[model samples]
Target: MPTVAVPQLSVADLDPATNLDAVTERVAALPDRVDVAVFPEYALTGFVADERACDAALERDGPELDRVRSVAAAHDLAVVAGYLERGAGDDRLYNALAYVAPDSDTTVYRKRHLWAGEADVVTAGDERVVVETPAGSTGLVTCYDLNFVGDSAAFAAERVDALFVAGAWPAAHSENWRLLLRARALDGVRWVVGAGRTGARNVPDAPLTEYAGRSAVVRPDGHVAAALSRGERDLVADLDPAVLAEQREFIPVLEATENDGSTRRNSRPGSRNKNGV
Candidate 1:
C-alpha cells in the first residue's frame, strides 16, 4: 500500500513565494510514512493569463522549482505540484505539473486538455506522462482532463496503479469534480488522488471565483477512502495494492476490457460474474 497525501489549499491571490512556501510547509507537516504528496493546480502561480501569466511562468530547471525539488528530497517522498511553465517560445506557456522524486529527475506533465479559456493563454500538451515509483507506477492528469475518460482509460491500459489529479476546479461545479474522480477510479480500477484549491481567487486579468476544496482519495470501487472538507486541509490515505487486487478479482473490468480490447454488452443486468466465481 502507498500512503498518499493531498493537501487542500486556498490559492487566492498568493504570490509565487507564498505558494511555494505553503507547499513546503505542508510537506513538512505531513506524516513521515507518506509516499507521495499531490498539490492543487496552479498552486504556485494562481490562475493568471495574458502578460501577467507569462511573468508567473517558470522554467523546469529554474530556481522556483529547485526549491520544490529540495522539499521533495528533504521529505524523502515524491511530490506532485501544479505550476505555470514557461514554454519553448518566449510567448508560449503551459499549465504544467511536475513530479519530483527523491534522488530522481523531475518529470513535467503538461496539461493536455485545456479548459474553456485556457487555450488562449496556455498551449495544450500532446503527450501523456507516467512515472514509476517504489510504491507503484503513477500517472498524472490536470483539471480539465477529468472530463475525458479515455485519457484515464489509457493509463489503465498501461497498467498504471495510481493516478494523481491536480485541479483548480471552481466551487460551482464541484459535484462534477467529485463524480469524475470516483468514476475514474471505478472505471479504471486504480487509486485516484485528487487535490483541489479553495477560497476565492481574483486573478489580475481573469474573473473572480471561489475554489472547491473537496480534496479526496478514491478507491477502485468508486468510494472515497479519505476526503477533506471545503477548506485548507490534508487528505491522507493508504492505497493498498491488495485492496485493488481484491476489487479487480471481484469486478475484473479493467483487465478484461483493456487486455482483450473488447467489452461485454449485456442486455440484462447482473449478467456478469466475478473472477473467482
Candidate 2:
C-alpha cells in the first residue's frame, strides 16, 4: 500500500514563486510514509484564461520544476503538480501536470480536454499519459478530462492501478465533479485521487471563479476513502494494493471493455493480472 495525499490548495494567480513555496512547505510537512502528494490543477499558476498565461507558463526543465524535483529526491516521495507549460518552440501554452519522483525522470502530461474558456488560452494535448508511480501504474488527467468516459476506458485498458486527477472544477458544478470521479473509479476498478483548487480566483478577463474544494480519494469500489470540503487541507489515505486486487476480481471492467474498438488492452505481458499488478 502507498500512502497518497490529496491537497486542496487555493492557488496564487500568476505567481509561481509563492505557490511553489507553498508546495515545498506542504509536502515537507507530510509524514515519511506518504508516498506521493497530488496537487490541484494550476496549483503553481492558478487558473489562467488571459494573456497573463504566457507570462506565467514554466518550462519543463526550468528552475521552478527543478526545485520541485529536488524536494521529491530529498523527501523520498513523488509530487504531482499542475501548471501552465511553455512547450519548446511551440507557440501556445499547455495546461500540464508534472509527476516528479525520486527514482525516475519527470513525466509531464498536458491536459487533453480543454475546458470552456481554456481552449482560447492553451492547446489541448494529443495523447494520453500513464506512468509508473509508488502506487503502481497511474494515469494522469485534468479537470474536464473526467467528463469523457472514453479517457477513463483508455486508462482502464492500460490496467492502471490508480488515477491521479488534477482538477480546478467550479463550485457551482461540484456535484458533477464528485459523480464523475466515482464513475471513473467504478468503471476502471481503480483508485481515483482528485485534488481540486479551493477558494476564489479573480483573473483579468474571467469572472471571479469559486473552485469546489472537495479534494478526495475514491476507492476502487467507488467509495470515498478520504475527502475535504470548503477549505485548504491535506486529505491523506493509504491506497491498498489489495483493494485493486479484490475489486478487479469482482468486477473485471477492463476485460469486458476489450469487446469495443474505442479501447483495447495494450499488452503488457507480465506487467499486470486480474488480482494485482
Candidate 3:
C-alpha cells in the first residue's frame, strides 16, 4: 500500500499573507513528509462584493501565485489553495483553486457549481481540472461543487486517485458538508481531502456568515480517516493506494457503470432470461 500524506488547513478572516504563513506553519508541524496541502475557498480573501473582492483578485501569472509556487518549491509538496481570480474582463471574477506543484506551473480550476449568490459574484466554470502527481492524478473542486454528484463522477470516470475540495462552508450546514465529503469519496471510490475556513465574518451592510471549519480527509470506503473540529485549523491523513485498489477490485462499480444506465442484470445468475422467459 502506497501511503500519501496530506493536510487540511482551516483559517478565518482570509488574508493572503497570513493564510500563506499559516500553511507554512502547519506543513512544518507535520511529523512525516507531506505530499500535499489544501486550503479553503477564498483563502486569500473572504467572499465579498465585486469591487472589494476585485481588490484581492489575482491574475494567473501574478505575484500572489508566485508566492504560492515558491511555497511548493520550498517544501517540495503540491499545494492547492483557493482565491478570487480576475477574469478576462473588468469587474469579472472567478472563484478559483490554484494547484501548485513543485517545479511545475500552476493549474487553476474554477468553481463550476455556484452557491446561492455566488453566480452574482463570480462566473461559473465550464470545465474541470485534473493533475498528475506522484501519489496519483488529483482532481479539484470547490464548495458547492460537492452538491453535484456528476462533478465528482466526472473525475471518477477518469479514475483520479484523489479529489481536493476547497470550501468556505457555513456552520449552519456543516453536517451537509461532512456527509457530502464522505459521499463524494465513497461514490467515486477515491481519496478526498476537504479544507474549510473557520471564524465569523460580519462586514458592515453585508450578511454575516459563520464558517464551520470542518476540514477532513476521507477514504474510498466512506470512512473519515482524519478530521478537525468546527474551529480547529489542521487535519492530516494517509491515503493508501492499496486500500483503494482493494475496494475497486472487490466491487468494480466503476467498470460496471461504464456500460451506461441502460444495462440491467438478473437478481440471481439464472433467475431471469434475457427475453423474460
Q: Write down the lDDT of every candidate, Cα atoms only.
A: 0.80, 0.84, 0.73
lDDT of 1 by residue, 73-155 (tens): 89899888899888654667889888887753577788988988788889998767667764577778898899987787777
Worst 10 residues of 1 by lDDT: 268-277
Worst 10-residue lDDT window for candidate 3 reads 260-269
Residue 169, model 1: lDDT of 88
Clashing residue pairs in candidate 1 (N, C-alpha, C atoms within 3 angstroms): none
For each candidate, give its TM-score against the true structure.
Answer: 0.90, 0.92, 0.86
Error of 1 at 10 (Å): 1.4
Alpha-carbon deviation at 125 in model 2, angstroms: 0.2
* Position 168, candidate 3: lDDT: 84
Give the range where candidate 2 is weakest over 10 consecutive residues by summed lDDT.
Answer: 264-273
| Residue ranges of candidate 3 with Cα displaced over 4 Å | 1-14, 88-91, 259-277
Which candidate ranks first by TM-score, i.e. highest?
A: 2
Residue 66 shift from truth in candidate 3, angstroms? 0.4
Candidate 2, 243-266: lDDT as tens digits: 889999999767866522232221
Clashes of each: 0, 0, 0
